[model samples]
Target: MEMIVHNPTEGIYAATDDFVHAIEVRSPSRFLFIAGTMGLDSDGVPGTTLEEQLELIWANLRVILAEAGMSVDNIVRLTSYLRDPSYAEANAKARVAALGGRRVPTTAIVAQTLASGWLVEIEVVAAG
Candidate 1:
C-alpha cells in the first residue's frame, strides 16, 4: 500500500510529478486506520496531565490493535493533533516512552482542541 499527503489547496489528489514531496507507506500485510482518539478515558473524563493523556491514548491504541490481532510494532503511520504545538517535544518524549522508540507516523502538529479544554487527539494507521 502507499500513503499520500497532499496540500489542501491542490484540488484533492492532484499530486505533482515531484514524488519526493509526498510521503508514501507500503507494507506486505493489512492496512489499518484508527478512529480519531481524544484525551477522555473509557470513564469519559480528561486524563490528569499531558503524560497521563498520552498513556491513555497508548492504552486505547493497544486495545484497538489487539482487537485486530496486531500491536504497535505493526503500525505504519500515525497522526496526532495537539492543543498546543509547543508541547510537541514533551509529547514526543512521552510517545517514545510508550512505543519504545522514536518512530512517529507521518504526523502534523496543530494547535486546537477538538473539544473545549482538551489537549490532544490521536489517530493511527498500521500494517505489517
Candidate 2:
C-alpha cells in the first residue's frame, strides 16, 4: 500500500514545517483507527512537562502501530489534544522526531483539559 500526501496549490499552505493538508491511501490497504493515547507509562504515571508528555505520547503511538504491523510511515493522519497552547511547539517537535521528518496530515487542538494530569493526548490513523 502506498500513501499520497496532497497540498493543493489553491489552499492555504500549512504554517508549520513538514506538514501536509491531506493524505490519500491507495487500494489494498488496511486502516487502523487508534484510540486517543496519552503520555502515561505502563505504571500509569504521566510525564512532568509538555515535551516529556509529547514524547511519551508519540512513543505510545509507535507501540500501538507496531502491534498492528504498521510503522510511522503508514500513518496518514494525526490529531493532538493539548491542555495548553504553549505545548504546540513541543508537540510538533516530538511528531517530527518520531516520524523522522515524514509529514503526515495533522490537527492540533488546544483544550481546556485532557484526562486527569495528562499534558497531551494523540490519536493516529494508519494505513497498511
Candidate 3:
C-alpha cells in the first residue's frame, strides 16, 4: 500500500501514496528534509569529541524530528559531512550507536563541513 525510497538521489522521492504525516508537509507528506545536524546541543554548547559530537547531533535531530511529529523510523536517508576525513571510521562507529546499531539509513559521505573546527555534520531525509 506504500512505497519507500531509501535515499533516492535528485533530492526527491516519487511515491504515490497520500502522506499521512511528514516533517514538512505542504500538499503531501512524502519527503522531508531535516536541517544539517551539528554538535551544537540544545543548550548551545558544542561537543568536543567525535563521540560526543555524534551523540549531540543525533539528539538534536531527534528533537527536531519530534517537533515535526516524526520519529527516527521515518528517516530514509542520511548525508554525513565530516570535518576531517581521518575521523571517518570513528564517525561511522558513532553513527551505528546513534541508530541503535540497527537500521542504518541510506548514507552519503563528504570529507568536509561548513563550520570551522567542526568534526562532523549530518542531515536527514525522512518519508511520512
Candidate 4:
C-alpha cells in the first residue's frame, strides 16, 4: 500500500513534526482496526508508571500486529488516551521509537482510564 502523508502548509494550522495532519492509504489489501490496548502484563495487570506502561503497550502492539501479519510499519494512524496530559511527551517518544521514527497521523488526549493503574491506552489502525 502507498501511504501518503498530508500536512498542508496553508489553509490549516501546522501540525507538529512528530505527527502529520492525516494519512491516506492507497490500494490496501486489508485493514486492522485494533481496539484500545492498555499496558497490561501477562497476568493482565496495569503498569504503575507511565514509562512502564508505554513499554508494555508497544510490546503488546508488536505482538498484536504480528498476529495479523503486519507490523508497526503498517500502522497508518494511532490515538493515545493518557490519564494525565504530562504523559504526552513520553507517549510520543515511545511511539516514535516503536515505529522507528516514521511518523503517521497521531492524536493524544488527556483522559481518565477505567483501570486505576493504567496510565495510558493506545489504539491503532494498520493497513496492508
Candidate 5:
C-alpha cells in the first residue's frame, strides 16, 4: 500500500515533525482500526512511571499490529491521549522509537485522567 502524508502549504504546520496534517492510503486491501491501547501488562498491571507506561503502550501496539500481519509502517493514522502535559515529551520519544522515524498523520489530546492509573493511551488506524 502507498501512504501519502499531506501537509498543505496554506495550513499550519504541526508542532513536531513526527506527524503530518493528513494521510491518504491508496488501494488498501484491508483496514485495521485498533482500539485505544493502555499501558497495562498481560497480568493487568499498569506501569508505574510515565516512561514505563509509554513503553508498554508501544509494545502493546506492536503486538496488535503484528497480530494483523502489519507493522508500524502500515499505520496511516495515530491518536494519543495523555493524562498530563508533563508526559508529552516522553510520549513523543516513545512514539518516535516505535515508528522508527516514520511520520504518519497523528493527533494527540491531553486529558485529565485514564482508568487504572494509565498515563497514556494510543489508538491506531492501519491499511494494507
Candidate 6:
C-alpha cells in the first residue's frame, strides 16, 4: 500500500513534526484496526508508571502488529488516551521511537482510564 500524507501549507494550522493532519492509504491489501491497548504485560499486569507503561504499550503493539504480518511501518494512524495531559510529550516521543521517526496522523487526549494505574491507552490503524 502507498500512504500519502496530507498537510496543507496554508489552509489550516500546520502539523507538527511528530504527526500529520491525515494519511491516505491507497490499494491496501489489508487493514488492521487495533483496539485500545494498555501497558499490560504478557501476564496482564499494568505498569507502575507512565513511562513504564509507554514502553510496554509499544512492545505490546509490536507483537500485535506482527501477529497480523505487519510492523510499525504499516501504522497509518494512532490515537493515544492519556490519563494526564502532561503525558503527551512522553507518548509522542515513544511513538516516534517505535515508528523510527516516521510520522503519521496521530492524536492524543487526556482522560480518565477505566482501571487504576493505567496511565495510557493507545489504539492504532495500520494498512498494508
TM-score: which candidate is best?
A: 6
lDDT (Cα atoms) of all candidates against the true structure: 0.70, 0.84, 0.68, 0.92, 0.85, 0.93
Arranged by lDDT, best first: 6, 4, 5, 2, 1, 3
Tens-digit lDDT track of model 1 for 1-128: 45444344455554232212334565456778898777678987988788778888888888989999888776666777888877677766766676677354446578668576577878887775
> Considering every candidate listed, which one attains the maximal lDDT?
6
Backbone clashes, each candidate:
1, 0, 0, 0, 0, 0
On residues 1-128, what C-alpha lDDT tens digit does candidate 4 reach at each position? 89998889999998886898889999999999999999999899877788999999999999999999999999999999998988989999999888999989998999988977889999999999
Error of 1 at 6 (Å): 19
- Report each candidate's C-alpha RMSD, comma-separated, in the order given: 6.8, 1.6, 7.8, 0.8, 1.5, 0.7
The runs of at least 3 residues in candidate 3 whose Cα sits more than 4 Å from the true structure, single-residue gaps closed, are 1-28
| TM-scores, one per candidate | 0.73, 0.91, 0.69, 0.96, 0.92, 0.97
Q: For residues 8-27, what per-residue lDDT tens digits would candidate 5 score against the true structure? A: 76657444677777788889
How far residue 32's Cα lies from its native spot in candidate 2, in Å, is 0.6
Error of 5 at 113 (Å): 3.1
Off by over 4 Å in 6: none
Global lDDT of model 5: 0.85
Q: What would the C-alpha RMSD of candidate 2 be, to one decimal place?
A: 1.6
lDDT of 1 at 110: 87
Q: What tens-digit string does per-residue lDDT give for candidate 3 at 45-118?
A: 78888888888888888898888888777665677887777776777776666666544344546665656657
In model 5, which residue pairs have backbone atoms overlapping below 3 Å?
A: none
Look at candidate 1 and give me any clashing residue pairs: 78-105
Query: What ranges in model 1 sit over 4 Å off?
Result: 1-27
